[model samples]
Target: MCPPGTMRNSTGATGIHQCEPCTGGHYCEGYGNTEPTGLCDPGYYCPANRSVSSPQPGDLKCPKGHYCLEGTVEPYPCDTGTYQPNEGRTDCIPCQAGFYCESALEPDPQPCPPYHYCPEATMYPIPCPNGTFTYDNETGLASEGECQPCISGAYCRGGYIMDACAGGYFCLSGSYEYTPAGDPPPANPDQDPCTPNTQCAGPCPAGHYCPVGIEDPIACPNHTIRNTTGASQLSDCRPCPAGSHCLQGDPVEYECPVGYYCEEGMPPEECPLYTYRNTPGAASEGDCYPCRAGYWCNDTGMVTFNQNPCPVGHYCERATPYPEPCTGGRMSTETGRRSNEDCPLCTPGYYCPNDTINVHGIPCRPTYECPEGASLEVVCRPGAYCEGVTGVPPDCPGGYYCPLGSSSYTRCFFPKYCPVEVKCLWNVRLDTWRCHILD
Candidate 1:
């Protein structure tokens, strides 16, 4: 019999003349046989003839980037869009999703690059279209649907880069070129052919502002106004001026109302307490004047001073916080006293203490005299008499004499008879009385 590794083609041939090694890509395991036992297994190659002395002599694993099949003599290269990263591969692997294998005999597939996408079994990455973009770091995209469209208020020409519209301009979606306000149609339409989907538009209109990449102009807020055109930022709107007020988006200011004052950019405020403003267009608190003398403005936002005059017996000064009573021996019978001087003194024959319009003065006492405007009563002098009904004192009577602080007269005796009834004289040095004889 031939050696285990050798094979015999003719049956029962002479000793070893017809015996030969197993054919390439085949194996012989048992003792002598007419033909090879079996072909090489898949994922393996048989490069040289096999011998029984050495087991499976030419059998080898397929190399990287190649594949092998049963009965194969040499390894085959992987086709395009397929790869073999490991040895002993029976079949090439199709490229994975989001990856590409561009050429044959590739060991591994490549991830899709930025701005490009790939599908399974793809040989090359596909680029994203214009007016769309992808981030530079974004890779391994799976399909064309993975690409992004350009955002509104911005533009993307190509290459996955987005740019904002310039100041004083606006942009819409899918914009490529900058646009401006178009001239009136039919007159000069060619000069400004305002195209849709343009990156930028008009310098903004009056009372409105437009920021970069904005789709439309924004109106000025309340308490602010604008007059000129081409406003690009919110700061272009000016505050309402003093002495005037502005509503939202107002181009002109309105005058301040009567009894109120308006400051810049502020709401109208009523005039302060104890103050008034009769006219419109008051700019600040200073424009609200204090109530004049002899007047009392008790509430806020008074428009007239004459409506509330100072009451009787009370004095009021300019800008007085409250009314003052007439006191200190002074009184007033009338209304609207401006100052202490305006309150008159008490009347004659009466002593006024804390007098008012309703209550005049107290009567004089019998033993005392009270002159005009007297705050207190005065005692009668020697040789004089006073009556409680009158405010003045009188001399002694013809038949009577008076002493100090006397309210009535005393009668003369027969021994001290009066010589002159009106003038009775006494001599202190002689200690005797001398008078003219009575008629």
Candidate 2:
């Protein structure tokens, strides 16, 4: 039965009259006909997974959550982040704030708005942003966002902001340690970094200059003394030898030596040590010749004997070596190492070799030689013997082993005195030396 406002096919040859249009939920845009049906309008949803084939005019259908197109019977569903168009669309679109439509003509146009760019490296967007910028790689197409100015004294080269400065440079100013800034930074010549820590100022702290194009303070040059105490500026230069001028951070520039000229820049090479030259006023430390075996620089007697004599007993042995032990009776910093190779040879018998060694022998080790005039207290194997005021041999104790040929038959560390010649006597009960004596 057709509910109100219905049209029936009364003229048909059949006896029963048939209703032409189905009322309720159905609409007919044209004149009433034998067969007519209504459909849901746009924004009005039906059920999901619905299908409509060969849709007629003035008909709209959609899935459960989506309304049909406004003027068509086609059915479409809405996608995530978007809503179905109340028109002839087959899908949904992104909602505001979530995404943007690239353009109005898109089937499912994507959304794009302000506030952020994509990717990394290569700054872009003209004036990209303050503290926020974009880097475009391919012909100004896409860009990536990166942290701004990460380091100092350096920068990210154009697009390569992901890495550090190039080489031989550091990032103190901010940015990659490799990239150079617009204005060149201060140059610290002479390896003097006017940077961190002041404890290691060469020769004199606060009394030098870091020279042009370099960093850190440099030591006063040859022939020049450090006059400007506590270095800050390089204006404390004074006149040196006749031919020299103050160069670098020098207090006084020295003149060229007789054969050599002030070569490198204002002044050149220094006169070799131990030789005299027109170095400072007329000479330098190097200009002094290394005295021969008989001649020393610290003392005098050059005409007939050693001049500039070495301190006391120390000989003029040349070329001091690292780990050099005390030598020739001269004490040195290396003494604690106890490298006997450093000690000077003891005079015949006096300060006997190995006297100060293990168990308090001579200062040197493996010293078989004894002191002059005095015989040793005990004799050891390999021909070493006790040469002393007492004629008796030394006695050893049980559990205590003595070197081959070591003996005196007088005392022992374990017992105050030995029963008899404890050492050098074949032990009666055991195979070793007869050291233990029965009470």
Candidate 3:
């Protein structure tokens, strides 16, 4: 019978030369006869040399960081990108996602480092691409997709985290760098920075504003404007000044038109009724002057005074919308009277009606009395006489009698004798004429 470590192929063996060591991967036991007993078990290895004793001399356990399979001749190191932490292992472990295994003899895989990523079975971590970044302290990034693209308004150069764009400069999404106004486009724009003057990124231009992350410069709205270049935010735009108007994106303000007034951030307004502005750039409502005296401005937006003159029989004060009629017993024959004082009193011996335009009023009758500024005629009294020349009736003379509304006086007729103190009359009761007392 052959020993445990040796085996013989032939059934009939003549000498020790016929006995052979067990195959390197297989084990021999119980005094093997003919063929080897069995293959080596997993996680173990066997050598070709044999002692032919109860315990094999060349059999050994797989070492750490190495593996062995059935019928193995020698221990095999774990493949690159794989690891084995335990001894006597049959197979190596592949590197996990988000981890890296650099050497076949490594005991364990390593976590992916910051700014880098690793895929399953990776031997090394890959750095984030240009214009992209990873968190400063982040680790275990599984794949290239884990790397983040640079945010708008911020930039990320290769191997760098993030940096905010400077004032008056702009950065777009996936930007590697910031751009300023008036700069030329960068060479290799895909890998470098954004181009100048393009919507991608640049400094704000005149009459416009550019906020962070903006693709293009924004125009200042109407009623607001900016003249200087490189405005970084909306606040940089200023409101249009009084007496001027600003259109959208205007670099300069325009003067208000004649007959109009303008205020900050507001459209032009026409001069109000009874007001006028003859020149351009009226700054506000106060800039419009009131209609001048002797003129009437009934309509709005007058550019000049005196367009409508005051008519006869009426007067116009400053800022008057309509002419004022002269008061009763007053007369005016001329145009453009500025005040009631311009109207004159009615003429003597004449009666003037209300709002009379005729300089000379109606004539007084021979029996009526009309004084200056008189609006109506007055009848003459019986004791007085009135002629065209008299504004007030004249008293009758001594020894004279005047009838109602009489223009002249009558003398007393002779009876016995004329009485100087009373009007002379006949005494009907007395046969001879006698002096009678007058009432």
lDDT values, one for every candidate: 0.71, 0.35, 0.73
Q: Tens-digit lDDT track for model 1 on 1-439?
A: 8877678887767777578887777776777767777887888777655463332343377788788888767789887678888888899988987999987567678898888888887888887665556788999988876777555456565536457755554443444434444321111125544444333234455676768776555778877887766667989988989998888755667888888999998888999988999998999999998999998888888888777888876888998888787665666777778997787876666676654432356777787777767777778765668767447778777777665567887777777754224434456898754545434
* Candidate 2: regions farther than 4 A off: 1-90, 93-268, 273-439
- By TM-score, the candidates rank as 3, 1, 2
Candidate whose lDDT is highest: 3
Ranking of all candidate structures by their lDDT, best first: 3, 1, 2
Model 1 clash pairs are 5-51, 5-52, 419-436
For candidate 3, what is the lDDT? 0.73
Counted clashes in each candidate structure = 3, 87, 0
Q: Which is superior by TM-score, 1 or 2?
A: 1
TM-score of each: 0.43, 0.23, 0.47
Q: Write down the RMSD of candidate 1 (Cα, Å).
A: 12.9
Residue 421 miss distance in model 1 (angstroms): 8.2
Estimate, for each residue in 1-439, the C-alpha lDDT of model 2 and write its tens digit: 3333244445553422344433333343443434433454554332222222122322343443343554333344454435544454445554443233333333342322222332222112222232222234322223333323333322443333345334323333334323333323323323543333111112123225333212234555544545543332334433344445444444544455443334333443443433223223323333434434423333221122232433332323442122222343223221222234434444333333222232122431232333322223223442124333222323344334444454332334444334333333445687644443323
Q: Higher-TM-score candidate among 2 and 3?
A: 3
- After superposing candidate 1 on the true structure, give the runs of residues whose Cα lies further than 4 Å from its correct spot: 1-219, 227-232, 354-369, 379-390, 393-439
Q: In candidate 3, what are the lDDT values of residues 1-439, reduced to their tens digit?
A: 7776788887778777778888667777767566677777778787777533322233377877789887677889888788888877899898999999998777778899998888888898888775677888989998877777666567676546466766555455455666534542221246675644233444555677767655445788888888876677888989989999888877888999888999988988999999999999998999999999998877778888878888887888999878887776766778888998887876777777775554557788888888878877888766678887457777767676665687987776565333444444335676443444458
